[model samples]
Target: MRRLTIWSIPIDREICAGDNLGDLLGATGELADGDVVCVSQKAVSKAEGRVIQSDPEHLDEAFEAALAAETRRVLRVRGTTRIVETHHGFVCANAGIDRSNAPAHALVLLPEDPDRSARRIRDRLRFAWNLHVGVIVTDTFGRAWREGVTDVAIGVAGVRAILDLRGTADWTGATLRVTEVCIADEIAAAANLVATKAAGTPFSVVRGIDPAWLAESSARAIVRDSARDLFR
Candidate 1:
């Protein structure tokens, strides 16, 4: 039987620009070999100074400008919400910008290169702790037909983003097709069970992942190319 365990690590202090996230997380002393670390996107953004000031007096115009700056193309607009493609090729609401959980009069933008951000954190941890682990940067995203939101992996390192099971045989001895699993997103969602948005728990550790899944990977692999995307 495969078993898994997950728990949150509370960041004792607010993460600010230029903060060393690797050092801060390492200080938590909760990580172990083979543990997958799920970090909130807000924490990474704050640390990386990926924030922009929004004028409160003209917030709507400021927001629109920010949205335009971050957006690659506008796909849908309903009321004040926008579903658009970002420069990073992520299709999400408002280009993955967040007004909540940000410094006053500021908006947090997604990391410039999430895959690279994940690698930096992974490498830093490897150097600091001498432990091999996977790192995932997570953000909340709404599904096309689903209600509400769930955390998904926007960045991944030292972990397989997708588990392709197309040729695998099931218990009934049937060949499986089109059964690729988004491992990073699923892990991020599971971590959200403990790393609640308002809990100040920006980090979570998922243990007991299949060791075979630990390898060089990035979340970009999870994005479906437009040529194959039917919804867009």
Candidate 2:
């Protein structure tokens, strides 16, 4: 029988600047091999010093210039500014600059290199605990066709991002069509079931996924490049 265990563990406090992730996780318990640890991107941003301070009510010329330089397109505009998609294919209000739940006079943005962040964390955990576990940094993102939003993987290490089923034979011996599975996104969603936004649970562990599904992979496997994106 296959057994899986999902654990939602609370950190001592919200991840902030100067907090050592290895120390924090070590205080909780030993991480086992084949475990998938999902971390919220907000925490990763905080750790990476990707935070700024600005008044939400005011859109200064400098702020507008920064947004223009970073965004691909201006989705909508209100009084001060609007939501925009970054060159990296992430769409969010003010290019992922967020002021929520942050210290006063600060707006948090996504890490500069999320993949590097994942790799760093994965390496630290492995060295500290001697375990072979995968790491994923996740964030809540709004979908084009979907109403609400769901957590998705932005950074990953030691996991296969996609399960390609193209040209694979189905149960009836017919070739399957469109059978690729966004495994990272699915794992991110499953982790969200335990890591709730309002509950202050920013970390979760997903166990029991087939070990074969996890190979050293990058988020690029899951993110659709602009030229290949049909919806855009």
Candidate 3:
């Protein structure tokens, strides 16, 4: 039988710009080799200074402007909500500009380069703790036609982004096809179980992942190419 364990790391200090996230997380003294560390996207954005100040009096206008600035193109619009493609090629609502978990009168933008951010944090952890572990930057996203949101990987490092099971055999000796799984997203969602949105927990650790899945990969690899995107 296989077992997995996940838990949240409580950080007493508030995350701010110029803070060394790797250091803050490592201070928890809970990380170990073969573990996958899930970090909140807001924390990464704040640490990387990917935040914008919105006018308290003109918040609506400022949000519109900021959304326009971050968006590469609009795909769909329903009332005040927009489904758009970000410059980073992510398709998300409102350009992924999150007002929740942000400072007053401010918005937290997605990291400029999430893959690079993941890599830097992984390197920092490796240097500090001498432990090789996977890192994932997570954000809450709503699924199409779904009623609620779930945390998903916006950045990944030292972990297999997807598990391709095509051409593999399923139970009862059936051949599988088109069965690729987004393991990173699954892991991120699992981490969110412990790191709740209202809990102010910005980090979580997942253990018991398959060792073979520990490798370099990016969250961008999970993005479907525009030409093959049937939803677009």
Candidate 4:
């Protein structure tokens, strides 16, 4: 049986804009093949300088303005909550604007291009360590009917975003009809368990990735196409 292990990498200092993630990870430990590097979108946002200011005193208008700037369209609204579609086609609350984690009066927008960010980090790690590893950047998100949130892959590189086993046979020799897996999101959720709140753990390593699952794909591949989307 195949087994996987996850462990958090404690980041001693808060990640700030212009900080080099490759340099930071290099100091952690030697990386190996098939190692999945899972990163929090919060940290990636800081590195990419995706921050804005909202007045602590007049938060209502300022927060709404920031949300408007980031949102491509408002999908739904209930009371003060808004579900929006971002330019990158992500549909989430407030276009993924985060307000709670940063220092006072600051808000963080999602990375400009999460897939590109993942590729950059993957390339840097490969160049420095000569190890072919996968990289996934994650963020917490609420599902359509789910009560709570779960971590999902907003960025991915050197990893399989989706695994289609639709035609494969089951253990009972029955043909599987529609069995597809979202590997990236699943891995991100698992990593989030370690990279939790009040822990300062922004990074995690998911070991024992199956070699067959190491193909390249972006996180967007998992997003439903606008044409085929039923909810929208």
Best by TM-score: 1
Task: Order candidates by lDDT, high to low.
Answer: 1, 3, 4, 2
| Predictions in order: lDDT | 0.90, 0.78, 0.90, 0.88
Runs of candidate 4 with Cα error greater than 4 angstroms are: none
In candidate 4, how many Å is residue 19 off? 0.9
Q: In angstroms, give how far residue 156 of model 4 lies from its true place.
A: 0.5
Q: Which has the greatest lDDT?
A: 1
TM, every model: 0.97, 0.88, 0.96, 0.95
Per-residue lDDT tens digits of candidate 4, residues 1-232? 8899998898988999998786687678856788999988989999999887666787767778788888888999998779998888899988898888886888888999999988988888889867788999999898898799999999999999999999899999999998889999999999988875887888899999898999889988988888899999
Candidate 3 lDDT over 56-145, as tens digits, reads 987778888889999998999999889999988888899899886789989889999888888988999999878789999998887888
lDDT of 2: 0.78
Ten consecutive residues with minimal summed lDDT in candidate 3?
195-204
Q: Candidate 1 regions off by >4 Å?
A: none
* TM-score of decoy 4: 0.95
Is candidate 1 or 3 superior in TM-score?
1
lDDT of 1 by residue, 60-164 (tens): 677788899999889999988999989888899999989887778888889999999889889988998687899999999998988999999999999999999
In candidate 3, the residue pairs with backbone N, CA or C atoms under 3 Å apart (3 or more residues apart, or in different chains) clash, namely none
